[model samples]
Target: MTRLVSYDEAPPEVRRVFDDIKRTRGVPDVNNFWKALAIHPPTLERVWQNLKQVMAPGALDPLTKEMIYIAVSAAQGCEYCIASHTAAARAKGMTDAMYGELLAVIGMAAETNRLAQALRVPVDAAFRAAPPPPIPKA
Candidate 1:
């Protein structure tokens, strides 16, 4: 039988963090991922803190960040992350049309990345030997 850790069964430190997360996020209970991470409370706490801080409104707009997240998840083929982040992106103001386009772009990028990897394409010798592009004049 599959085993899952109940929040009450979590380690002391994990329980603390889980309680805080429940209070802050207004969730009923922790998910399986966190329950597994609860085996290492410090790592769980650190990851939770970092995720909250990074995902909060910041210099990069939340929707944009969510788009970036969705793109990365799609590239990595993380179905759970793609679903979650896509929902987050929609919540942050992504339209259906925008989501469709975002998905198309990610798909194209993934295909190109795979092609590049498969061919082991090397950089043009001249491009590699040349200095970086000059900055545009103001």
Candidate 2:
């Protein structure tokens, strides 16, 4: 069903990408996305490298990054990305409770964002600054 070159039938360059993917993920299986991308070796390599750099540990933890990916994917209505990120999140130790809470928060935020946009809500001045601490008792 794939319109692109299959993994086993790929050229050396594409095969190299597949090998790297296997080693990086520590899994023998390559997903359909990568396999489809093999038709264009440069694109496949570029995408893989970018993914590696972006997903690597930084200011944000891997799990948090995955959750963010899921949220954005959901908002964008990208079912493939959502499912992919959800699985990655689970593999990164996301619990069922955390997943449920994540979805709830995403839904609430989306609804409120739409409501705010519809009403043309202005930014509240109070929300722009952190609250000052209480004065110490004498």
Pick the TM-score winner: 2
TM-score on alpha carbons, each prediction: 0.73, 0.85
- Residue 72's lDDT within candidate 2 is 97
lDDT digits (tens) for residues 1-138 of candidate 1:
235567867777878889877886688987666776777778789989988899878669989999999999987888878888887788879999999999899889888988999999997998899998788776
Best candidate, lDDT-wise? 2
Q: Deviation in angstroms for 123 in model 1?
A: 4.4
- Whole-model lDDT per candidate: 0.83, 0.92
lDDT (10s digit) by residue, model 2, range 1-138: 657677678899998889999999999878878988887789999999999999999879999999999999999998989999999999999999999999999999999999999999998998867688787676
Segments of candidate 1 deviating more than 4 angstroms: 1-3, 118-138
Per-model root-mean-square deviation over C-alphas? 4.9, 7.0
